[model samples]
Target: MAVNYPNGKKFLAESHMPKTTKKKDLIYSNRGMTLEEEINSSNEHYLSSGRAVIHKKPTPIQVVKVDYPKRSAAVIREAYYRQSSTTDYNGVYKGHYLDFEAKETKNKTSIPLSNFHEHQILHMKRCILQHGITFVLIRFSFFNRVFLLNSSYLIDFWEDTMNNGRKSIPLAFIEEKGIDVAYGFNPRLDYLDAVDKLLEHTNK
Candidate 1:
């Protein structure tokens, strides 16, 4: 008599099983840290230093299946997102509501508008209507440059796209409209310095 498995393959000993690296683990090990990781670290630093109270919005996931190999351990085998998530980060800064989306692009010449979803743009617009400060932190990974772009500018281009305009925002336009955020040692991205400038301009 032979033992069988779910997929009609014989069960192998633990030592004979091939080792596999998770996609996120491979990304971290091979490409340093992702943009989200860097921003989360920066947010933690800001919170500890009393600079801001920002947090990453957790995406709700629906777990479909759980495998209980042992009574003490259970692993999720299947899951899906419950719904589309809003911006990456949101919180209160100096009594002002702050909301922002973070994105990275490898394209050297342009950042495509398609990278943004319709719901995200609408969320930013709604935030603005409520007098909340909204912006986007975009990184041009290839050039090792990061920028803080006001949501107003992003919305302008997004609306233009609806009118059948250009499909992407050129790097030149971004350089002109966006503020360059300095990469630093402590907070890492140092985007709040750029935010200060935006606040000053708005107040004036």
Candidate 2:
């Protein structure tokens, strides 16, 4: 299937990125699910439990070609995105607007800043000005560890990149500044737990 961006660039899904290591032996193991899938499951749990109502942002696409093998089975052969997306997920939590992006990296030491785009960062900045709770869910796939880093930290690092600063956020920096989100059976990734902690710290 051929998928293209609105600007005619080929769409490369994150799942298509090359894997460098086996994740089964890592801590907080994924059980073969991608980061996006795990977050989706957690969102479903949050919604069902009445804790939050967050959903992944869907990319609008224009189907260019489709093949129908059967009357009920149709396969999309080509498509184009209608516009660029701002963030991965957004909704409301406890009456606070929530907007966030999820990033996964096989690199154990750092997650590249390139995982985020300028337009996405701009959108997050605007949300922050509107008093929205904006943050990022970063997963180090090699270690199976996840952290919830506030968007302010991300934006600070992003702006530095334009001036020839480090291209990735070091794991040490994340460990010191971000909140650890435990992976569990029911919710998969308990990010809201970390979010509550972040809120408390901010309130103090």
- Top TM-score prediction, candidate number: 1
Best by lDDT: 2
Worst 10-residue lDDT window, candidate 1: 16-25
What would the per-residue lDDT of candidate 2 be over residues 1-112, giving only the tens digit for each residue?
Answer: 5643233224445565433222432443566788887888788889989999999988878999986553333557999988665897999988889899999999988999
Provide the overall lDDT of each model, using Cα atoms, as 2-decimal numbers: 0.83, 0.85
lDDT score of model 1?
A: 0.83
Candidate no. 2 TM-score: 0.79
Q: What is the lDDT for 158 in model 1? A: 92
Candidate 1 local lDDT, residue 87: 81
